[model samples]
Structure formats: structure tokens, C-alpha cells
Target chain A: MIASTSIHIERTTTPKAKPPQDKLGFGIYFTDHMFIMNYTADEGWHQSRIVPYQPITLDPAAKVFHYGQTVFEGLKAYKTADGRVQVFRPDANMRRMNLSNDRMSMPEIPTDLVLDAIKGLTHIDQDWIPDGEGNSLYIRPFIIATEALLGVQPSQAYTFMIIMSPVGAYYPEGINPVKIFVESHYVRAMIGGVGEAKTAGNYAAGLKAQDAAKEQGYTQVLWLDGAEHKYIEEVGSMNVFFKIDGTVYTPSLNGSILDGITRNSVIQLLRHWQVPVVERQLSIEEIYEAGKNGKLEEAFGTGTAAVISPVGELNWLGVKLVINGGATGGLSEKLYNNLTGIQYGKLEDEFNWMVEVK
Target chain B: MIASTSIHIERTTTPKAKPPQDKLGFGIYFTDHMFIMNYTADEGWHQSRIVPYQPITLDPAAKVFHYGQTVFEGLKAYKTADGRVQVFRPDANMRRMNLSNDRMSMPEIPTDLVLDAIKGLTHIDQDWIPDGEGNSLYIRPFIIATEALLGVQPSQAYTFMIIMSPVGAYYPEGINPVKIFVESHYVRAMIGGVGEAKTAGNYAAGLKAQDAAKEQGYTQVLWLDGAEHKYIEEVGSMNVFFKIDGTVYTPSLNGSILDGITRNSVIQLLRHWQVPVVERQLSIEEIYEAGKNGKLEEAFGTGTAAVISPVGELNWLGVKLVINGGATGGLSEKLYNNLTGIQYGKLEDEFNWMVEVK
Candidate 1:
């Protein structure tokens, strides 16, 4: 282990690291150490630390509770075959996080600082990067308004923190298809809003709809544009993808759907594979028609947690469109295989997306 | 002092055996005690408390950190001229808060329970209520997700808290004028979104645009609808009012505008004054043209804290519409005086709006 024998190491104290194999669940288990930083209007971003995971006490009147002034990002670290804990395209996550911060009126986190924090935390939790397919350490970085002042005029104080959680495979027994309930009444995002930003409010807005969808025996809810409820947007927490006519197509990231890291990676991989891809306004009617006409071969949702969750059937307005018979679609299967292969260092790192941690 | 000398009522102590006889400022100070309750999926809402003012410790991964799972209501307590602590139109705030709770998928605080909690806290903080015109104890009741889970699901745990702050009069020196900034780019709320709900996300989403407006010396950002920027929605947190000719015109209570308690109260008072109050789409262009034609007379925004904030000038795209001097308009002064009169018990509580506590 790289210890404080190196320079620039500030207050390094190692804890007894646990094996990465056993995970309580995705967000349930956290690593030993985390990166923290505070930002005040007076002090740009002071008090940076990689401290042990702990609870944060807040004034009951903190603006975040009353104003929803918070944003976050999710990505993961993979345990490669050669005992290397690697992060996939953290730069994209960092950039998107800043986008979320800017949209939410929160201070921007510098790219270098985001990189440094994640690298530092993952290094400290290297043992927490579990091995095997579908197992990894889920890294969550978030920011919140910490001002004690009750009056809301852009909080003068804020806190940014990065916490890591060990996650089991999203699907324990290899990849499989999941059903989705299309939400037409409850819109996920609207034009000129923070739809592209990974803010908590957006997610909170989706919960009730998601709960209803889940109650209808669907694993997730597919969100539609608020303006035109017919336009396809995204799944519960991931970006939607479709494979049609030997080509890959996903909804355009038009200021509403999250610019997910895994979504970007999938597009890049599809481009690398020489498949024609289109990112345009995908409509629900088009998908329903494609499925009915046997042209919609596969559908999936992509994000850091579930690398690619295949959609077998879509329940929309009481109409069911089965993309696959609750089994992983062929193209989805290939995409998942290729993405996981690159993540686990089994395939060549052609794009050099993985960053190695000592 | 009604307190526990054992179980129910032994009259333990009182901070001060009398209420303050001065007008209060806006959200600058608070009552001595507050009420809180918790909710989890396994155990619905439990552990309700009427605790002293204190900070709450939260997990870093709480859903409130990432998803804007938060909402709030604002009302006030007034010490009447007869030394009675009363609240004006409080059920409106409670009902509106429940509407917000439903929009965000949060468990609704029972109406009677809300009354009990508000009564409990106000009784404990009776001394904080101000007994003068435009001066009242501002009460902020808010709910937030507290589940430590990282994934986006309606937080398994939630917090319902009520914190009171002694607010000085919104217009300290009596009715003053506010300048509004018209933005064509950023839209605050959208149709089918949480615009009707008093969710923190709505305010958090608007801070940047609001800050930009303030930087340009504008008091608040006048939001337009997301679908078409032509229609006027609201000015910051308050519901806006416009006057053309002798009839008062306010934007229709579309789902994109908050269902403000003060907005409703103002509507009733306007009707009481025999003024025509039309709730229809009032575009910014219409307001500008009307001002040019000498048809637009006055404009203002209403809320529980601010009560009635007059608009003297509207700065739109380098064109200034000086409807009135940077002072209170005629209609505004009347609304402010009458509304606050009923609040602090200066005027007879006509409409039976005020509920006396002790």
C-alpha cells in the first residue's frame, strides 16, 4: 500500500480494510474513508479532507431541506483482473457534475479536484473494489447548501462530499431483462429546467411515479417529456437506449435527460463497433410501433450502477410491448458484454477510459 | 407556562410570561421550540417530537442530499391587540402544504396533526409573536427525505419539521416597491411539473436566474412558462398581480404557478373591495403593451412572509416600464394594510380567518 511515505500526504491514518467481496447491497455499504470539502462565499473551497465515513449534522433550517439546493453524481470503480482498481471515465462524471452544480446555482467543483478526491478515496478503499462480474465500488459525489441562515438567497456556505459504497452485481445471476412502466401522467422533466442536471430534486420528483410503476409489477418507470408526454425521456435512474434495424438509437440529451456517464460510454462503444447511431427525439409511439412491427429488437437503460439494464417489455397506458420474453435481448447482451469486458480489463482499453489507482 | 411537571400539564416554565409587543422582522429569529416527526417505509411516521431548537444530524447519503425530496409552508402567529396569540388563514397553508406533499409523493401530514403541531409549537413560543402592524411570528413548516440510502427511491425515511423564525415586517418602513427582471431564457416552472407544489427544488432551480437578476439591480426574476416564454408565471416565490385599466389581472392558476395562500387571500380581499380579478394568461408582452398604452396601472406579488410586495417598475430587455415610482402603489398599500391588519389583529378579524390560541 502507498503510505504517507510519499510527500503531499496530509493527515494519513489507515484503518483495517475489509475484503471487497462481501457487500451489504449497492448503496447500503460504504467504504472506510471519504473525501470532503467545504465552500463558503468568503472561502472558495476550504477544508478538504479524506476522512472516515461519518454522518453530517445540519441545521434544521438549512436551505437544502427547504430549497432543494443539492446535486450529485454516480460512477464506480472496477477491480480489474490484475488487482488494479480502475475508474471508468471519471472525467465525464466530473464534467456532468459541474453542469449539475452550475444549473443548481451551486459552486463548481474543479475537474482536477474531482479527480483528486475520487482517486484519493478509491485508493483508500482499494480493498472495497470487489472482484467478479457486476461487483464494484459505487462512488457517489454530492454537494449541498450548508448555510445556517434561514433566508434563502443563494446559500453562502456549502459542503461537497464523495462517498464510496461496495455494490453487488445489479443482476446477481448474469444479465436479464426487466420490465418498465411508461409514465405518461407524471413527467420527469420539462424544457428550460434542470433536466440535464443530476440534481436531487429531479430524482425526488420521480419517486412517486416510480413507486406507482413498481406497484404495477415493473422494475422501473420510463419518464417522458413534460411538454409532450409522448416523447421518450429516460428510465427511473438511467438513460434509455434502443437497438433497431442493426443500428443503435437513444433519446437525444436535449436539456432534460441526464448526461449519464454510462450512456456516453455506450454511444462511444457503438460508434467504435462501426454501428450507425442516432441521438434524436425518440417518441413513445415510434417505440410502440417498432415493437409491434418486430423492428424493435432490444431496449435498455444505461447508468453507472446497472451498467446496462435490458428492458423486456414496456407497459405503457395499459398496453404491453414485449421487446424480449423477460430474457436479455441479443444486442443488449452484446453491449453489456462489451461494456463489462472493457471495465474489467478483459478487452483492450481502446479508448483508454479506465484510470488506474495505486 | 404549560409544560411537563410530570406528564401532561404541570406548568413547568415560560421563557417570558408575555408576548412581545413589537412588529417582527422576516425570518431573522425563531420560537423557542419546534415540532418534528420521522417516516420510514417499515415504520410509517413515528417519533413525533416538540423539541427545542436544535440541528439535525443526517447521513451524507440521505436522499435529501441528491434528490430534491423537500417541500415547505409559511404562515404566521400574531399577538392581537387584546393580547391573544392568533394565526390568520392557517388552514390554507396546511392545505397547500398537503398539496405539495402529494405532488412530491411525500406522506401527507394529517390536517389536524398539522394544526396540533403548529398549535403546540406556537403555544411554546407564544412570546415570539409580535403585536404590531405587519409584524408576526413567521412559522416555516417543511418536510424532507432522510433515508441514508444512496439509490433514488422515495427515501425510505423522511423528516417532517416545523421551525419558527421571528420575521421583521417584509417592508420594514411600510409598503415599498420592487423592480422585476423579465427573463426570456430561463423558465422557472413547467406544465405537469412541481410548479404548484411548494418544493424547495422550485426555488433552488431559480436561484441562479434570480441571482443574475439581482446582480443587474432587479429585485426578483419574473418567470415565464417553459413551453412558451411569452406567458408570465410568477415573480420569484410570490404570486404576481397586474392591473390593466381598473380591473386587476393575475395569471391564471395554472399548475406552473405555486398555489400560494397569500395569493388566494389577496383574491378574496380584491373581491371584497369589489375589484374585478381575472385569472387568465397575462403575457409579458401584454403587460408591456398595456403600459405603453397607459392601460397597465399597478403590479405586485403576494406571499405569507412578504404579504404584499409592490412592483413599481418592470425592466424587460432594456425597456423599462415605470408604472409607479419606487414606492407603494395605491392598490398595494390598501392590500398590505388590510391583510396585515387582519394578521396582527389591528382590524376586526372579519372572515373569521384568525384562530386564537390563548
Candidate 2:
């Protein structure tokens, strides 16, 4: 239960020879070392190791193979202007990860162990953190059921690993506005389903819809609620934000959308800056009417990878909308700047969101 | 596009010295060789191989890792009394597999390659097949998105594999009737979702509900429709059936429930035997009332893995009633025996269902 007692460091021999800032692809490249810990029904999670980047050998009958009993979290390590490495609100990600684990009937990862895993891997591979603007080490911390069994109970064995991939700007071509295809046919998660959790299944459900949207020449699939399919739920991989008047509104945690860490951070930042913020069920009809009536100013998505991707247009029910107030709004830009400012140590740390690593 | 070209076979060095028999756990023991084929946007499915049974090294950022862009089908190989190996209606499984692939936005496995891969692996691992009644080599053919990317689209690269695990009887206790937990909270799939597909995401979503049912002492979770959660969709891993009076009825494949291979067989078998069978929305309330009124006489599940499992009792909303008539019904017994008989070559293969291996 307490991971403080065991921690062993195995430094990477190759060490990426050249730093990762030079060759950063989304997730194609990896860091020198990664954090590893195994959990068994008998011993729990033990033998924490900072193993070099290598392929994991798993049995073909691993429960995760047949039954997708896996959950994951996405966050990043930012190299500040002062050459200090920091992670953004990792506790929040850990909390969400544990919540996802609960929903998937997986073992609860202690927040400290989660933090320890992060610190262990990120520290060893800290050099992979890219500097300059819009560059960082993309951290993927996931827990998977590793038990080799046929029966379908919660897996008795589990594996938690943190793998990092050096990533460049999500919108490498500046924060250009993008079009989102509103998927009326497919639903990501339901009222009693695992949508709120950052589990693998939620994303898997959206692949087909996303592909169809791409064929229609759209960036992401904006999923709707499963029950009614009237209310907006989430976009592919991100929680969305809508602006009306001078106020900001985003969909609330309604059991079917990922409780995004970035979504909450923006909400808090808006309130901290004295801007109006609302969390409620936002419907497509309201949005369509809002855009038509000049009330809807801007719409954007928020996630760890993409800080804020402005919506240039929203395509729904064969109707195309020119999202008013341009792709990048003043408020969205300001919020992004402030958020990244805290992340890259460019602004005063008012919320204390970044965790500095030695 | 064409798989008329034969694949290279990499023989296993460590074949099982003595294959397990009598008590082989489901999906626990595997054969020496497995069939594999790689796919790319340019070449399609190529480099097919019957490789040694080993762990596949997938990048942590593989699309299947982040998004559950994966689908699978399960059938079996039976060693008849003449010691000839044959697959039970593989073409049916292939058709369903392709349908599942289409729903998941994955490219369909060419029928030629699908047939070739199954034969390639099963032939090499023929010795692993168990003997006698109710024992067979469980064939699991699965396709996963192997593209090393983070974004949510149908993967550009893929890997298809067919792994065989020797299995003996789902329930070693002579097919005793088991109770099912009528799951009201957790939903498996929705009409406009990937429920019909044998995708990993659907199974992942069902794990939590299944775990809860296991905790409550139920064998499987009887999943309901996502809209109202009243209609019976399917049991944990099989299609459900019910006999109301002399009429046999099961929930029609209204887009959500899987078009199971075994389910289709049962419908055809009973039809051939002149038993009235209908497919429509069978609501939980309707069936419970029918059971109370003695109209509902039988309930069972049909799937490739579990040929048929009789539902002894259903715990629905605190109303637990033993299935009508007895522990096992006459029709269920007859159907099970007939199916198993045909599989083991005890019954005449009138329908041309079994495909003999070359």
C-alpha cells in the first residue's frame, strides 16, 4: 500500500543519445526510461523499477486481450524557462485515473504511488522534456489488467506503467480553428456507462464515428448523449467549452463525459479572473440557435494534449456553421496563455498547479 | 487484396511436450503456433505467418492501447471420432467477424485470408485439440489496430491474429442450470453504438456490471437495452433465449445485440426441427410475468465459447424465481445434445456446416 518503502532506479544506457526536443513526434518516440510496478493478488503492487524503454512481454491470454479491462490518463511534463521540469496538476489526473479504475473494477492506485511513478520515470527521462513554446514530454500513465485467466471477474493481477512520448504542438500550425462533426448516430458513453472515466473503451467506441467524420472532412467527432442523443456530451479526446455573451459555459460532469482536468482548470481560471462561468447541460439546438442569434461567440475543446483547439465550424445534421467570433477568441487565448504561463513558469503561480521535479 | 499467396510459417521450437486434457481451463492453455498477418494502408493484409506462440511487442502508443480499436470472434475446432479435425461453420464466423469489423471502422479481413489463417494455425496445432465429448480447440480470431498513433481514427496499420486455446467444457458439472443477475444499472451497448460488433470496448464496458453480478453470486449479467434498460439484450457473453409456452423467442438483432454464430445456429436448428421461434424485443417484465404465468418455460444463452447455458433463475428487481418446469428443460437438452452431436460427428452433417481442414 505504501510505495515509499521501495524504489529502485535503473538508468537508461542509450539515454536517447540525442535529446527528444530535436525529434518530437506525437507518440512515435519515447523517453529513455519508464516507471514499472506489478500488482498480484498475493503481494499487491511491488518492486517499483525505472526500467529502460523496451517492449513488454505479455501472455496471449492476458485478461486485457479478451476483455479490455484497462484505464489510462494523459498529462505532460513542461520544461520551464528556468530549466526546471514540472508536471501540471498530476494529482488531479491520478484522482481521475483511480475513479476510472473504480468504474472498471480495477485495483485502486494510491495517489502517492501514482505520483511516485510519475516522478520516477519523468526524472530519469527528464531530458526528453522539450523546451521552447508548445513543446513538452507527453506522459501517458495507464493501468491494465495483466492477469492470465479466462473467468471474467476483476483481474487479480494488474500492471501500471508510465510511458512518455516527446510531443510538439498539438496544433503545430498555430491555434488554427478546426471543424467538428456532430455525430448524431453514435454515442460515446451512456448514463450508467463508463464515459466519465478515461478508460480505453470510451475512446474505442468513438473510432468509427471519428473515421466517418474524417471522411466528411472534419477534425473530430462531437459525441452526443446516448439516452436522448439531443444533448452534447464531448468531442473526440477533449471536453468542450462554449462562450455566450461575455460568459463562459461548459458541460458539467453528467456521468457520460470525461471529467477533464484541463476543462476544470479553465473553469477555475475563468472564475479566478472574474469571468462568468457555467456548468450545465448544453444542447445542440441551443448552440445552433446561439450561433444564429449572434450569442455564441466561440467554441473550443480542452485536454492535456491540446490545451485549447478553437472550433472554426461545427457540422451537425447536414448543417454547417461558421462559428462566430473567429476560430481563436480573445478569452480563449487569454485563458490558454495564463494556463501555459503557470505551466512554463512564465507567470506567477497563483493556483500552484505545477509540481516541480528535482 | 488477394491472399492466394501462401504465408511463411515459423514453426514453434517449444511445442507442448504433452497437451493437457480432461480439465483444460478455458483460454488458459494455448497451442504451439498462432496465425498472424500484418496490414498497412499500402499493402493491405500481407506477410501472413504461422508463428511460434509468443508475446507480441506493441508500442505503448499503439492505437489499440489508447483507443480500443479492436474486434474479435470465437469459434472452435472439433476432433471427430474419425480423428479428422474440422471447424464448426467458420464461414458464418467470418461473416460476423467482418460485420463486427465494419461496425468498429476497421477494414474487413478478406474471406480468403480469414479462411487461410484459421486453417494455417489450426492445422499446425492440430495435436493440441482435446479428445472425447465436449472438448475442442477454442479458436479466437482477433483484429487490433496496431498503428502507433494517438489520434482517434481507424488505424492506418493493423495486425490480425488467430490464437487457439484448448478448452474442455464451460461448466465441468454436466451443464447444470445457472442463475443470472438481471443487470439494471450497467448497459452493454446502444442501438447506434458498437454493441453489435464483437469489439473490445463493448466487453470492457460490461466488466464492471459483470464484477458486481459475480459479487452478488450470479453466473453472468443479463444486460438490458440502453434506451429504457427494460429489454433483455444478451447475457454476459452470449445471446439469450426464452421459451414462452410452446413458442421459442429471443431478442431480435435490432442493431445492438450481437448476431452470434451459435445463436443463428440454434434458430436454424429449432426451425429445422419444426419448433416455432421468433426474434423480437423480449422485455424483462414480459418474460417475468410469463414465467409467473407458466408461459415462459425455458431460458438459455448461446455463443461460440459456451454452446448453450441454461438460465436456472433470474434475479430481477428482488424477484428471484426458478425457471419454469425444472433445472433443465427438454428442448434445451435436445438442442444442446443435437448441436454437440453434430460437432463431434455423432449426428449426420446434413447442413454442410463443418469445414474439414486440408
Candidate number with greatest DockQ: 1
Give the range of the ten consecutive residues with the poorest summed lDDT in model 2 chain B: B1-10
Candidate 2: regions farther than 4 A off: A1-5, A17-23, B1-4
lDDT of 1 by residue, A86-168 (tens): 99889988888888888988887767866887898898778777777678888999889988666768787888889888888
Chain A TM-score from candidate 1: 0.94
Over B202-274, each residue of candidate 2 has an lDDT whose tens digit, in order, gives 7778888887888899988899988899899999889999998899999999888999888999999999999
Predictions' DockQ, in order: 0.69, 0.64
What shift in Å separates residue A126 of candidate 1 from its native position after superposition?
2.2
TM-score of each candidate structure, all chains considered together: 0.92, 0.96
Per-residue lDDT over B1-358 for candidate 1, one digit per residue giving the tens place of the 0 to 100 score: 1121111212224443333435343565566677887776666666677877778998888878877788888888888777888877778888898888888888777667677778878887787766455667878888888888787777667888888877666666667888899887777778777889989888888988999999999989889888778899999889999988999988998888987788888889999889999999888999999998988888999987688989988888889999865567789889988988887777876678888775
